[model samples]
Target: MALKKDLKQKMISEIDGNKNYISVEIELQYQPDLIHLLREEINYIGQRFYYKSKDYKLEMCGIGYLLEARYSHLEHDEIYEYWQNIKEQLNTMVFHEDKHHLKFFGGFQFSEHSLTNEWKDFGMSHFVLPKFMITKENGRCYLTYTDHSHKFDIDNIEEILNIVESKAQARTVSEPKMVANKDIQSEEWKALVTKVVALMNESVALQKVVLARRRKIEFQDNVDVEDALQRSLDSNEASYLLLFESGKSQFISQTPEQLCQIENGKLYTNAIAGTIARTEDESENNILKDELLNDSKNQFEHRYVVDSIIHDIQSFTKQLEYDKKPTILTNKHLYHLYTKIQADLLSENVLEIVNQLHPTPALGGFPKVEAIKFIEHEEFGTRGFYGSPLGYIDLENNGEFIVSIRSMLVKGKTATLYSGCGIVKDSNAISEFEETDLKFKPMLKALGVM
Candidate 1:
């Protein structure tokens, strides 16, 4: 605390001495699992805020936040509506970067599995510099964010501090309180679970039937979107949405697994399903991996995911590649079989494939349509962006979409964390409940859920 306080004081002093400039560079050395927590889901857009840091990460390109939506769910469509609206929104709306509004990318989508090693091509990536970048450089995961307020002077720090102090100095708002009741004891959810269990018993081939629960939190403060996000993210909670856009463009996320990424023309993807937390030691981790792989119920649950992604990409590209076997990625919290798949993306832009690939079995279910239907009416209220793609593909469409897992929706100090596990026919609700406990690690740690 002293170090951070001193650092902030020094930074402010420097700015004050400068008299008029806002060239501030802030860095946070995030922990490893914490970095992965950020990686768990990708929020492509937000109202308007900037944050960056590099702490702990696995292996991949380092990415970071660009700019907030200034308000979540900006009528950004105006930027593309007729292409002329771009100028209108620019004139009226506040964007992260004033000059460049969007980016786009072109790549092929494959389902048959091809390009397992070439991840840079299809692996998710972002332009970290010139703003923020989240990716792997060296071995550690690092995120670098740059803030250049056009409103501030570049030569004088005081000039910049004046604006930031005035704009960003809002008092930390209070946490929103939620009301829970005994309604859950005999709630429809209890009945829904029973019906789902019955369905699992009747179906011989069905692998997992993951179910979810929802509760509402009323928004209280007239808080800025960035404040809402910071409260949740700084806490290590599992959720991806934060009340933004003055309560309009709510930040929603749906990530738990890497579906696919395409760059240049290569496709990169991972197969993530089946899980168990670490009991400790390397051997303990290995045991969990083995159990997940051999378990019929687990395997069946994972296959649905593998099949969904494989087929989703097929609609866009023909050439593909995949590792004959799935590799287990052991995190402190859980284990997942991740197979690297790649392919030569066709001439279509990246969005062509992304549009069809979201909500794979890892999130929805085997059959996308059926799963979505079940989730919508069965999972309580709207999943909103909870299971949806929550990252940037850029205006150039050259960005990665992370499965918004291990995340939560933060409206204020109080936030809601969410976790889900694929429930196969043999899946026990109690055990699956435990699985969610493990999946909750990333966000839970972030949100102080523990």
Candidate 2:
């Protein structure tokens, strides 16, 4: 209570004293579960974002709209330029750093021109400078607020603080419930995969294309986003659990693939492909792992990802390095072939590098432009933010992005789950269909459907 009062008084004093945008952060001694707090305190349908990494977590509520960028109906090449314009605006804004500072949280759609009206709230690309944010790192928690108007309302600040304190003290754990689930266009999706593989085998300029399917689940009562996120965090501790809410829809995922990360003048990312299921028996698990490593079809699928990433990033990187052999990354439900790539960055613009490397062979396909064309024309449903990049960029040019996979979009009682698998010349339609099913297990179990 004393800390809240002190923070309120300090915010009021700062706003009264400054003419420019005011940003303040106060460290809290006690740690609170971020998603639990969000579920209890956030009243608005949209204007919420949650991110959890292995070492750090951030939860943001409310939107001050200090700076926002949205673009629709833009070509692939033009999108990067639009982002540069937004970055220019962000560069001019004055920020006060206190070891911990606020960053823009958002992501781009899978395709700018292909985005449907259903995802109007997300736009082609969107990012927000949240009004209030809670960040936890290194065993400490901090609360931050940004006042773009330069006039703080002490009463509202007090209310927010009170809610935080109450939620921190009286946390309740919710139980998961089973839901009714249906696979949307199951047979059609399998047929599409078969066609794609046949085309690839016929040498139709498509070597490898990834196909996705959606599962719609309905619950008797309104689904709790926090509970769903908690389940993901508990199941996949090594992966990134993220949420982005816009209007009434929330996009959430627990992804193991990192799109890109730049730190200390170096760039790092991974090639994560070639999926196999994990078994309860150690011997069976080892057999599956070895099969994934030695399987020619899986290796061919994975090499495209590594080669495409390396080719795309070579322009901006001085020295690139990666392991010769990919090791197996095992989660609770599955195993993936993983290879780490590192390089010294030659360009300070990290977003530019991100643009070039996004939709790698793992997500899109080989011969990038042609594969995208086929996906746009052949895919049965909209990709929305699935298999796209989502993360934050700081003032220091250091950021991390994860490919949004093993994800779902929730609206009220209904949730739409998304999963995809890589298709190659030897890929069988039935096998690919089964692979997508395996991919769906993470989100399915998280939603209490499995």
Candidate 3:
């Protein structure tokens, strides 16, 4: 109570009429089950964003948007220009030493091309600063409130607290049952993979081109976001648990691939490709891991990823280092060839780094531009955000982004799951199809539809 009074008084004295926004934060001693709060489904808030790190160290849930930037078909430079304006407008009240809750969370579509009507709400690129957010990090919880005004309103602050305090009783909702499932263009996708492989064999420039497919599912009833998210969290703790909800659509995923993590001019990323499915037996899993490491095809696919990432970022990086051989990274249903890469950045321009490094050989293919062109022309439908860089960027330009694989887009009773695999000259269409099947299991299981 005293803290609230002090904050109100402080805002009154320090409010600058010229500024466009104000953000204030207070630490919460009481740790509420954030997932439970989400289960409450506060509809009036309109939109919500959720992110939990792969390591289980950071969890955040945000409600509504105090400010947001949404754009379609904008070039990378233009997107950064809007971000610069956002950075200027963001006014964070220095409440304490821990100033970590202020962040812009969202993502860009995989391509700038025209997408299907299902992706209408997501746009080409969208990011938001939540109106109210709860963050749990290193055993501490903080509630942050941001308003689209220079002057703070005590009534608004009080109301935000009241809304959070009025927690709903936990309910036991059964997972929605699956009614029908459709694999969109299964035979066509396999044929496309074979065609891409033939193109790779003919042209040395395009050694590898990643191919993707979509699966549309129908449920008996409307799926509960909380239920699906909770199941994903329980099952895929080793992967990034992420959700971006806007209006009637929600993009949710538990992805194991980390595209980039920038902090204090240091860049951390992983070259994650070369997939193999996991088995129930530990010895079988080990055998599969060894096979993945030595298999010429998988190794070739993984190398393209490592080489392309280094090629793209070498100019912007110093002392960049990664292993010559990739180790195994295991998730719920699959194992991936993983190579950790780190570098000291010549510049801390996050957007430029994202621009240069995204659509790497892992997702797009080797020889970046050519592979992307092939995907644009050949891919069945547009990839709105699947396989794109999806994560948050903080006010200081230090944040993490994970590749959006093992994901699904949910709208009412229908959900569309997405998965992809790298296609090389030696790749077999049937084998690649199986790999994507493994990838789809994570989201399928999450939705209780597998």
Instruction: List lDDT for all candidates, in order.
Output: 0.45, 0.76, 0.83
Candidate 1: misplaced stretches above 4 Å? 1-46, 49-191, 203-208, 215-256
- The pairs that clash in candidate 3 are none
Candidate 2: residue 383 lDDT (0-100): 91
lDDT of 2 by residue, 1-450 (tens): 544565555555545333444555677677766766687755645778888774445444433345555666433344444445544543122112346556667777787537665576786777766677777766666677666454544465445566667754454545555467799999999899888877887896989988888998888877788778877876745778888888778898988878998888999998998988888999999999999999998898888899999999998898899998899987777889999999999986666777888899899998899888988888988998999888877656677788999899888888888999989888888988888888888787677666
Tell me each candidate's TM-score. Answer: 0.60, 0.90, 0.94
Show where candidate 3 strays beyond 4 Å. Answer: 1-18, 44-46, 166-168
The model with the greatest lDDT is 3
Q: Mind giving the per-residue lDDT tens digits that candidate 1 earns over 1-450?
A: 122565556654555322221224332243233233332324433322222211222222212223222211212232223223222222111112222323211112112122232122121211122233333323433332234434433333233222222322335454443343112222565556566777768974443455654433333343233433455456442222312121223332323455556666677776777666767688776677788778776666777777778888886676778776666765445667766777777743544455577667887676677655666556654343344443444433345555656555555433445666675555556665556656555544433223
Q: Give the top-scoring candidate (TM-score).
A: 3
Question: C-alpha displacement of 179 in model 2, angstroms?
Answer: 6.3
lDDT of 3 by residue, 1-450 (tens): 235677678767876656787787877777767777676647633489899999978899988787668887745666667777877876677555787577788878898867679998886878887887888888888878788774467576666566566666757757677888999999999999988888878879888888889999998888777888888877755899899987788999888888899999999998998888888999999899999999999888888889989998999999988998899988777788999999999977777888788988889997888999899988998788899988888878888888998899989999999999989898899988988988898888888765
lDDT, ranked from best to worst: 3, 2, 1
Candidate 2, residue 331: CA error in Å? Answer: 1.1
- Two-way TM-score contest, 1 vs 3, winner: 3
